[model samples]
Target chain A: MSPSRRHSDPQPTLATVAERAGVSRQTVSNALNNPELLREDTLAKVRAVIAELGYTPNRAARQLRTRSSHMIGLRFEEAQEGTSNATMDRFVHTLVEATARTGHHIVLFAGDPDDPLDGYDELLRATAVDAFVITDTYAGTPAADLLSRVGAPYVTFGRPWDDPSARHPWVDVAGAHGARLATEHLLEVGHARVAWLGWEAASRIGEDRRAGWEAAMAAAGTSTDGLGVRITDNVDAARMAAHELLEDPTVTAFACASDTLGIGVLHALAERGLRPGVDVGVVGFDDSLGAQVTWPGLTSVRQPLEQVAIEIVDLLHTVLSHKTVTEPARMLEPTLVVRRSTLRDSAR
Target chain B: MSPSRRHSDPQPTLATVAERAGVSRQTVSNALNNPELLREDTLAKVRAVIAELGYTPNRAARQLRTRSSHMIGLRFEEAQEGTSNATMDRFVHTLVEATARTGHHIVLFAGDPDDPLDGYDELLRATAVDAFVITDTYAGTPAADLLSRVGAPYVTFGRPWDDPSARHPWVDVAGAHGARLATEHLLEVGHARVAWLGWEAASRIGEDRRAGWEAAMAAAGTSTDGLGVRITDNVDAARMAAHELLEDPTVTAFACASDTLGIGVLHALAERGLRPGVDVGVVGFDDSLGAQVTWPGLTSVRQPLEQVAIEIVDLLHTVLSHKTVTEPARMLEPTLVVRRSTLRDSAR
Candidate 1:
């Protein structure tokens, strides 16, 4: 009676497939797109019927009509420039897990922050992704120019340094706020001379974290002029710096920018016969797996990586759909996980 | 004279942009793709030329005619389901770093093992990629079916579970071999009551690792009748199991499937007032960040993830270019890294 039934071999449409498989259209779609969510037997039956009827959904036509590729593009600014093996591993894992929820996939494009605008142009012309999510943007990067030129819907993992007024949607952790919280925690516990072990001051994140430490010191009416602050990029440098700072004796607490540097600092402290909580309190950022696995586990600010990832995806989707976003930039609060690294046993 | 230079306003190609920017074509490409490799002024000039010309190269046409999309697809079997966040992150970071070396990008796709057939149709039907790399394939996954159907060249991270004769280009660390090596190390140290802490025994990797452990134990003339083996999926479960096994006073050494589980075992030993190297020797697989960060650092068999990733990409490139692979499947040797977890300072 239908166009498919009239043919010698009737091809099953969504309705026919649903009817034949004894499931709803939505169920059939779910079985095809996200089979993990469906029962094995139900999925098997639906697949068998679809294969038996040689039913092929016209994806191209559907994509064109809806303008939704069911695909997202992820642009990694750090990935191209050679990030540490650990950082890379965590990012990929988080990205895959986040996108799996939407039954969508990701296309990764890594570009140098120092490159001209051409890198953006190349990516734009290469794939037909519905939306884009950019990570780790630096000052005066070509990504900014490309993002503005293409006018493609996109979101960033970090704030752009060049333009605070840039109308791009972004999700970033309140680094300064978290650092201040860490500083305050140490002050409340009678640690007066709190030092700071951070990455290069040139990094925006480092600067923000430093600002928070200074603000906390100012609010507590403590003189920070004599407080130790060591800024370095390498773990070896941080270790050396920590050893030097510990020799001062007045430096009783340290707020580190990352867990990696914090670990190195811990090792250095241990070599000098200094206990973490009893001798010197330490607080690190990112609450990475290293934070938990370290001896006297690191008390650090946990960045909601999963939540940030989800929010970035959601923002990009909203922009792609031409919906109005309530906020151009959103900053999520970091939760300080009180682990053994900074807390005395009595405090816990 | 040329099609691009016909107008008074010449459209910038890589060559034109290079000439204007006073650099080589490769430099221009590098500047665009990898700015970190270049100086600041050169990058700025390249951007100026690109902006002035408003030049956009047709990537689709170039990809079609040259058979070079400059893009590769990364297929993961359980990436959408079963992998840990840490493992996933490392793989993604490794893949990104490995491919960036050749100026290629990665598109990630998750395949359903249950279907073992139509799961990869979406990736196949969409944009044409230069090559594909498959990771974490189960026994009955859709990878083989997709490979056969698409006719595109692909490399697998792990070997085929069934059909040892299956001639697919694969790059995997010899897990079983690593396990055997670990077991042999324990035996060489006069440890007779060595136990195995394994992942899910249902997996091909787990089975292979177990076989290696058995082979090594048997070679040392030890009976497998009462071997203490704990198989689990959760880290806490492995820790609890390790605690129970230690209570028996027979399990002297343990070789775990992963560093995560090994760390858990170490934590359990510590909880019972027993030091790992002094009371119970331990070895782990994957030699991940978890292994290094843990106290009395974990002794692990390193899988050479970077080497494997690079080799897989190289193999996929060759296969895509229609080159005959001299060796269809290559097995890499896993190296044992001895740390405080395995041997006391005096023992070493």
Candidate 2:
């Protein structure tokens, strides 16, 4: 379904409302903008005609010109001290930059973090957003189902977790590939018993990333027993888990599912007076601002968020142009940013 | 000037464009939506007239209906990890929520980090945004200067740092008061020689916050020799400065201008095997997400960002309605959130 398509009826203008209500164009204008100027009966009659004629006084004008609102709807997620907040924030900045080139701008709406459907429904009712860019599909994409049912144009930043064949254009970073790179680097640096501090198995992204660690460990002919730990993604939880895992002296490196977990490891090391990048190695995902600015600087797998944003905008343009998407999904590669946290040769 | 004010020339519509071009309404519509339907000469004639008549095909329709675009322009800052990023991010979320109630939405644009005036000029030229919500005015607000010259409406989140009698409406948090609260709390908790870790002297926010720490220390009749330090606002610089400051055993507490600097203190203490909130107390400003979720959570002075956002929106409505603002500057007080970093009662 083309996102820009609307009803074929001739759009009603101010003149049409004026003619239907048996009033001068000025009277109709006053009724719409400054109803206090009109007699009560005259205002009522003009308003009823506007309603009966299916004239949306404000949106009608936009529809008449472009057949679309050049605005793209995006839900600005809840503000929190979060690992992914920095990642999503940077991506949004790039998306804003990319959309500017096409004369389309992003309209950010606040929504309940637990309810992905909250802001989207309200935007659809109140605004003429031409399309939407959906994100945070880690649990599941109820947003995709809702948008598909409504025939609204949308592109997601994450792949549909449950269904690879979902009929939507999406751009996702290669999570499993990113984790594998981190594991390979740790192994190359002479850490055979590399641990994986990951999110709970239910998170699709966590599982995808963990799979890479598992594959890398198996390829290196290393036993994976007791080195894989699943926990909540917050710092305190990761810190406690990594602290306990550090008791095993053989586990000399960690490949983490998120920067939060990586930061947790740094804290755990600080408690024990262990020097990171020398005593042990760690790598985090998302390359968040938190990862870059933290003390000693966390080594992380940086998803190509800028490229993903550009690709998302390119897909938006395609759907808005009513062009068929030959390829429904685009996955970009993730690269590693080496910092002091993972440099084993501390002097180098 | 009222933000909604514009040139009084009658808005040109499709009918006007067609009449001037000696063509039918349908022909003009074709020239706009399907230019290939007309001969090259006719298309050129229609285009020339459309441009000359100032029929901003897409924007003119909106101008005709509301006389104001229901969009507010905001420049999304270059995403960075800092003490203020989370503060500004949360403020933006609240602003978006506040604008929604008034049938307005925020349009985010990206700009060069060093140039404050870049995106505003582009947004003014391209979009029909009714007004702008200027953030990051701590760097002297060149944007305010540009917007004032162009007669565009704008409200800054930060007060005019260099000018007390600036003309624009602004909503700013009470930085000095917040720091005073933090410093007083430290003194009340058995810390006499409290030290101040702040930004360089040139940063207006840094100086404002530092004044509070100085006031609190002096009010308690404490000497401040070798107890005040300033550096660039980053984790590494703060950490290094704090480490050197810690050589003085009498300076057992630190009140910092930012959470970034406060976290640096945590790092410095961790390296020295000193306990934060036990052997020493630490306090940060802005209560950023980094402060909230960091290990041994940082005690921080929290700006009333959500209330500030609401106030900014209210100011915007006043200007849009062409009302004279009797009071243009509104300052909200910041409160302190005590966490593990400042809790000397460890068992509690």
Per-model i-RMS in Å?
Answer: 7.6, 13.0
For model 1, how does the per-residue alpha-carbon lDDT over B1-348 read when each residue is reduced to its tens digit? 012222234335678777877889878777766889888988888777766655555454444345466667776433221112255455655677678777777877654435544335545444345667777565543566456544656788888877666677988889999999888877766678888888676778888888899999888888776564656644566678888787778788888877767877876875676767767888888776667656656788877777887788778767876789988788898999887787844453
Cand. 2 TM to true fold: 0.79
Please compute DockQ, using alpha carbons, for every candidate against the native two-chain complex: 0.17, 0.15
Clashing pairs in 1: A89-B89, A89-B90, A90-B89, A93-B89
Q: Write the per-residue lDDT of candidate 2 for residues B212-278, one digit (tens) a residue.
A: 9888888999988889898888888888988888888888999999888898898788778788899
Fnat of each prediction? 0.23, 0.33
Off-target runs (Cα >4 Å) in candidate 2 are A1-63, A82-84, A121-127, A345-348, B1-63, B81-84, B125-127, B345-348
Give the candidate number with the greatest DockQ: 1
Q: Candidate 2, residues A161-264: lDDT per residue as tens digits?
A: 99866889999998999999999999988788999999998999999999999999999999889999999888888889988999999888999999889989
What docking grade does candidate 1 earn? incorrect
Tens digits of per-residue lDDT, candidate 1, A1-348, equal: 011222133334678889988999878888877899898999999988887665655434344445455557776433221111244444554666577667566777655545534344555543346666777564544465466655656788788766766888888888999999889988877789888887665788888888898999999998887564656644456677888888888888888877767776776776576778877888878776666666667788877776787787677667776889988788998889887778755453
